[model samples]
Target: MNNSFGLTHIVQFFLFVALQVLLMDNLVLYSTGFCFIYVAFLLYLPLTINRVWLLILGFIVGFTVDIFYDTMGIHAAASVLLAFLRPHVLNLLTPRDGYDSSDAVNIHVMGTRWFLTYAFTLILFHHTAVFFLETINSQTFLYTLVKVLISTLFTGIVVIIMQLLFFSPKRERIDYR
Candidate 1:
């Protein structure tokens, strides 16, 4: 990728964070479902990004979100967790031939099935950690679990929609760190 494409990732990172704070934060359904769309930024990053940089980026995303939500570092924790687990999840879902450096993780490139599996797994875990961390009280476990599941389903669908709507095929590979 060219330097401009790398810069695009940074721009997208800010866009995602801004979208989450300014819009998605107010979009809750029946007080349960939520769209944590900022992580979409992480999901679409270059597959070859260094692990440490990925982790740091994740922390930055989470910290920015935490600042907006005023919920301390819950979002940061979940974002870091998602980043830390992303490589493992990629490994688990890798095709027998493995990923090409140019392989982009989007519905346009990876197809609906692979993309759905990838997004679902990561979002599920992220939501679980966020909800659980927010409420450690065992008595509210069922409510929290429902929120986690519902929010996961909601966010997954929105993320998919966002992918279908915004993620067009690239003429060339996009890389950033």
Candidate 2:
């Protein structure tokens, strides 16, 4: 990564983590719809970043959250799983026109439908893994499932709002040599 990109992501990493721990962490809706907004940092990473870096970033973010929440390794496991699945999810959701490698993965570039599907799927995957791991020894599958589903939807909504409100579409001009 270039200096600017690296700096930007560093700022974003701390910002997302800060917001998650300080604000969203305490804003539980009915003790079910938890919003894990920090995942947006992983979701919006540059498309050019390699899978290994993705995994590393994911673990770092998750571990940071785990430390704050005292949740052991559940966040790390879920974040790693999300990072591992990211490229596969992109491939599966590739548009007919295909995406440029440098394209920023956001609602502006991918459209509402694609963004919704992508965000919801990954958030659901991450939340499910987290809740399952958190309650592995408990016999509350139904309760855990409800939490996962509700939290997934809530997180997805927050992600979409962030994208819509803050992110703008990049306009690239191609030079045909």
Candidate 3:
């Protein structure tokens, strides 16, 4: 990545984290699904990013959110898991045409179906890890399950909307070769 790319990501990192802590965190739906839009940073990372760097970035983003939320390590842990699993998730969803390492993973590039599946899978993984760890002591598995599902749906919807509105891709075809 060039210096500008790195700087752009740095700016985005702070922007997303601030949004998560300042705004999204305050918007609670039915006292359940909390929006963790910060994960969008991790989700939209360049496909060629080093795994180690990705993990570290995920940790930084999550830990930043955790500090503000006063829930030490919960966000960090889930974020690390998301980062660790990202490559695998993308690999599993790779289109028959294949992926270009230079391209960003957004709805505009991957189409709506692929983007939805990719985003939902990662969001579900993230929310599951977060809710389960935070509610591990609780006896109600069903309640935890419901929270994870609702939160995943809410987060996924917001992510898709954001991509459609602001990050929509340019019109161009990606060659598998």
Candidate 4:
């Protein structure tokens, strides 16, 4: 990536973290759950980005969030895991040689069904890892499962909305060749 692209990514990363810490973290829907729209940063990274850089970026983003939430390293661990798994997940959803770096994974690029599946799978992975580590001692599988589901749903919705509202593709058809 060029310097401009790197700078843009960094700025977006901070904005996502700020949104997560300042806005989403405070908007509790229930007693013990809240949305985390910040994960969208990892989701929207260019498909062609280096895996190592992605993982590093994930750790930085998660650690920043951890600093804000005072939750130790849970977010960092989960974010790194999500970043590592992203390429695999995208590969599974997209055909060989069909990936498009210019496009963000969304309903417009991947179609609704694929986008929904992709988003939910990644969100669930992130939430599961986060809540599992958060509730390490209790081992309440059912409660953790519920939390993961609810939080993933809320976060996924917010991610989709933000992508639709703020992020726009260049409107050129990707040449899969």
Can you tell me which runs of candidate 3 are displaced by over 4 Å? 171-177
CA displacement after TM-score superposition, residue 95 of candidate 2 (Å):
1.4
lDDT of 1 by residue, 67-151 (tens): 9999899999999999999999998988888887877777887778888999999999999999999998999999999999999
Using TM-score as the measure, name the better of candidate 1 and candidate 2: 1
Worst 10 residues of 2 by lDDT: 168-177
Which portions of model 1 show Cα errors greater than 4 Å?
170-177
Where does candidate 4 stray beyond 4 Å? 169-177
TM-score of each model, paired residue for residue: 0.94, 0.93, 0.93, 0.89
Candidate 2 local lDDT, 1-177, one digit each (tens): 567778778999999999999999899999989999989999988766789999999999999999999999889999999999999998999989888765677787778899898889999999999999998857799999999999999999999999888886644321111
Error of 2 at 167 (Å): 0.3
Q: Please give the CA lDDT of all the candidate structures.
A: 0.89, 0.89, 0.88, 0.81
- Give lDDT for model 4: 0.81
Assess candidate 1 and give its TM-score to the true structure: 0.94
Structure candidate 1, residue pairs in collision? none
lDDT of 3 by residue, 8-124 (tens): 789989989989988997898998888899999999888778999999999999999899989979999999999999999989988897887656777887889988988999999
Clashing pairs counted in every model:
0, 0, 0, 0
Which TM-score value belongs to model 3? 0.93
102 Cα displacement, candidate 4 (Å)? 3.8
Q: Which tens-of-lDDT digit does each residue in 15-90 have in candidate 4?
A: 9899998888789778456687778888877777789999998999989999989999999999998998988988
